[model samples]
Target: MTLPDLDPDLAKDMQAIEIRIDGENRCLAAGKVAMPEIAKGEVLVRIHAAGVNRPDLMQVAGMYPPPPGASEIPGLELSGEIVATAPNVTQWKIGDRVCALVTGGGYAQYAAVPAAQCLPVPAGLSMTEAASLPETFFTVWHNVFDKAGLKQGETFLVHGGTSGIGTTAIQLAKAFGARVITTASTDEKCQACLDLGADIAINYKTQDFVEQVKTATNGKGADVILDMVAGDYVSRNFKAAAMEGRILIIAFLNGPKAETNFTPLLLKRLTLMGSTLRAQPVANKGAIAGKLRQQVWPLFENGTIKPVIYQTLPMNEAQAALDILRGGAHVGKVVLEVP
Candidate 1:
């Protein structure tokens, strides 16, 4: 089979299948969307694979809206070869294999990503595995390491241990010399977390995570807590955190509103912070990309860490991929492989 040539004139308008929402229904449809143009600092990527994330589901459900000036499409990360570069772009050129953390527009055949957001595909990783890296890795790097200040020899707790973010967090914290504790819903999922380098995997259905954290840390509690299920977990995480601990909230899967006592904040000297990556400035995301390249990309290159893909469906089967994610049955990322 011959690979398609990257010709700007011929690629002006390509066959880009995009997912569109019909009333309350979301479905993938064939359409002729204009090929993205390279901006001053952007590179046009011929996307081979795109990673599906929880934020995409929220966008499909009409809950999360794309930031101003971002692509209305729902994907957040992708791996592909560079097909074109903006005149000002010097770091990358056509035919470079790269993966990028995009703000939007990753569900199509091509995406115009900021040059700074793109990184060389790690040594010995397929497009599918590389595609799975950016979203979860970026989120975890920012929340767990940057904001939470997770240090070596500390006890770190992550909720939803079987999730893409959870698995990434477990591996990254362990790689940085932290003891990781994670919570999953089932025995099998708990074992999966343990297999992924978690020092302790709590079956949240059978045990209270706060109690488990306290017990595992010998009453010192977790030094850092990466939380996605915030609602009631906010109060519970407060109970599980050690003195001067940090609690970073990236999502509120249950509900954002929480009723928590301020006494813990005052007495424990704890710090609470939250962030949504998509809405952050491009420069900030670019800085994060730089850090990942320097600090985390080597992990993938040397096989010290790897993406755990639960399933890979054709790009046309994007809805099915989202269904698997919504059902919470997947142990890791659900990726969409583009032809």
Candidate 2:
């Protein structure tokens, strides 16, 4: 079938929401802007939706911005149709529906993504659902699987088990044969995580997660702990981690700096690593995308690993969408549909 001609530059220029800094919530006006050019190994995409993330909220709050060499616009991942490709980008063709992990610039109607970082959208998912995949999925996959080296039959603990990364990790770890344990604040959220294949769902607000994990794991502790809350969870994560276990810290939603006892970590012979998806280099991100496509995409295609969408909002209401994300009430991914 012949594909419709799509000029990404023109599309981006014609459609985009402008966000300007102010004391209160910033303004997101619809206006034209220049679309980025396709660089080496890059493909220009006509974005259909961009996932609203916590980092986007931080950017608007003047705390987080795209790392050096990335676009100033606020977005981390997007799903769209390929419009143009730079030389040597042979893997995709025009009109191919794809989702890509981007450092930034996904908030626009058109964005340039490194060709290698693009993954074919799995069948039976809308662009909005697919848009939610890259940032959270990639982040979880890299930290839980690659960095922490979680294996089948092992026990894994994930903090914030109802958030985007948490939900994705729960499903993926279970599908891959790991025993999942997760912590959430509310009973509903804990039940949701349990339903998503978590073997143990602890309501952190009501119970001590570390003690519960110890009891659940026969006093051995978990094989891995994926932590986003770093303040108090840091020491507890070490305590809950098993001998020779690995702890991967992805985000400090509570706070980055923490004073914690390192004795348990050292005694357990644990490996602690902290990582972020957005600040990673393009090549590294591309490699992760490729690996995820090869290993995890099949699970998604088979309906084993699904994108859990909590809500969808119009791109124009980006601020409200971000506010909801920051509120932490959602159980899964929140997406924003673009024009």
Candidate 3:
């Protein structure tokens, strides 16, 4: 694999992972792609690391595609030093270390990211840990804190307690003074959730989460629920929510289809909402970056909250990284190092 030159060669090709589909299988193979151009308000990053995510798997399987004008290569988050900057960009100059949220093209030696969507790597973290932050942190902060308005002293519940999003949500919610509850597939994973500061951790495989939540909250139910498994969990979430509760959906790993009853929603006065960050406007994502920098970055700086990286693989092993993510046995973030 060729590393970028001492000075970036923006006109040349760069190594990246490309999707090759044959029959029912989608393979991540190595290839060369042209270096991305830095548009106005954008900067070209010499990517040190890129975070693997479920969306990358979905894109490889043809279930998800890059939005219009996005690069065909798949990666949602990355950390690196700025190699070049757009003429109009001022906040991030060449040589700045930043982690950014991108619509696409993160699985490469270089990615062009909007300046507003980039946040400085927190003081104590490595590039691999910084790469892990943009996606889960942004999603959790937006859905759980910004949208759901999870308040201090409120009870918060998140499914998939060992997932990248789950670990992030657990730590963030705990740091903000919320009582956290999370559900995982195993007793060990439940213990992992408890270690992340969750007040309660339910093993959904052996236990009925609805019952556990009721008992934990003393029959009042959780004040806010962050759900990624939506199928039957939809109705279950409705049952686990408190009166005037908020339920935010970010993904549907159990399948998006569900047979849901609306009676509980009406009776419980539950507010159901969902969002995806990739397709949102750059301004919206930039605003989220600002919030994380101002509100969440301090947590990292002070060691109150930290990114949890389960594994790191070479950039060329992106498929292996995705395989680890697909298998669902891993905890926290899986990252790919460019060098």
Candidate 4:
């Protein structure tokens, strides 16, 4: 496909149809937000799509704030073509189809991202699918593999088994040879997780996940657990984890406060760790991006792993997309298709 001719003035001051927060509501509004300036080692992307994530919702509710020096816009992942590049950026050029993990500002029609944070769109993925990859894949990779060191042949348990993060974790862990167990709210969602390659799917509404994990692992317990619902699960996870187990907390969906027995920490020799991706340093995210390019990208290329999108809404309907996520009924990612 031939690229469009660039009108310098239009490129200089782009129209980003952004979601503005009104009192207790988020509404889409077209505004002339300044086109991001590319610093050294950065590239300007004419975004085709942007991913809507839980953090984006938090930001909309004013519970989460963008990091200092990051864009105030509420998107974390994007798929687009490179329109311009900084002088120091040689790895990418104009017209490259790339998906990136951005700190912020991806909700716009254009985004400026670090060269190191961008990866080529995998073969056979649509721009919307590619847009869905970065945030979930990066979060799963950093938490499950990097922080927890989830090994092959181990039992991996994840909460919210039908979420963007859950779907990515299930596929990646399965691809890498781990036996995955995930918990969901309904039998339908549980089946969805099973279809995504989970070995065991627990319907948390009906079954106690601790008992399910115990039965699945023959009372040895899960070797590693990726927990998003950390409130009460914090205590229950300790009970479900094996000796020398690792638990990585990415979010507290239920609530953060919890009263748990600390004896398991000593008895199981378990490691409990938590991280928020957006607040991490650029270097850290860049490093994770590089690893994803090398290790995980092949899985996408070979069809061993792919994003499961629940719905694609036009960028102008971002709030509607977010509402789907808030309902927690969607099985995978909710993507915003940019026009």
Estimate TM-scores for all models.
Answer: 0.96, 0.95, 0.97, 0.96
The Cα error of candidate 4 at residue 86, in Å, is 0.6
TM-score of 2: 0.95
Pairs of residues at least 3 apart in sequence or in different chains that clash in candidate 1: none
Give model 4's TM-score versus the native structure: 0.96
lDDT of 4 by residue, 1-339 (tens): 122366767566776656577777866566778778788788889999999999988887788889899988779999999988888888998999999999888888888899989999998898989999999999999999999999999999999999999999999999999999999999999999999999999999899999999999999999999999898999999999999999988889879899999899889999999889888877899999999999999988888988899999888788788899899999999999887
Which stretches in model 2 have alpha-carbon errors above 4 Å? 1-12, 23-28
RMSD of each: 2.7, 2.6, 2.4, 2.4
Candidate 2, 1-339: lDDT as tens digits: 111375534644656666685777664556677777788888888899999888888787778867888887788899999988886889998889999988888888889889988999988888988999998888988898888888999999999999988999999899989999999999999999988999999999999998999999999999999998898789889889999999988788779888899998888999999887787777888888888988988997888988999899888888788888878899998898998
For candidate 4, the 10 contiguous residues with the lowest summed lDDT are 1-10
Q: How many collisions per candidate?
A: 0, 0, 0, 0
Q: Write the per-residue lDDT of candidate 1 for residues 1-339, one digit (tens) a residue.
A: 112476655476765556676787876666678777777898889999999999988887778889999988779999999977887889998899999999888888899899999999999999999999999999999888888889999999999999999999999999999999999999999999999999999999999899999999999999999999999999899899999999999899989898888898779999999888998988998999999999999998898998999999988888888899999988989899887
Candidate 4 deviant stretches above 4 angstroms: 1-5, 19-28
Best lDDT among the predictions, by candidate number: 3
Give the C-alpha miss distance for residue 163 in model 1, angstroms. 0.6
lDDT of 1 at 157: 95
RMSD of 3: 2.4
For model 3, residues 266-308, the per-residue Cα lDDT tens digits are 9989999988989999999999999999999999999999888
Strongest candidate by TM-score: 3
Q: What lDDT score belongs to each candidate, Candidate 1 first?
A: 0.90, 0.87, 0.92, 0.89
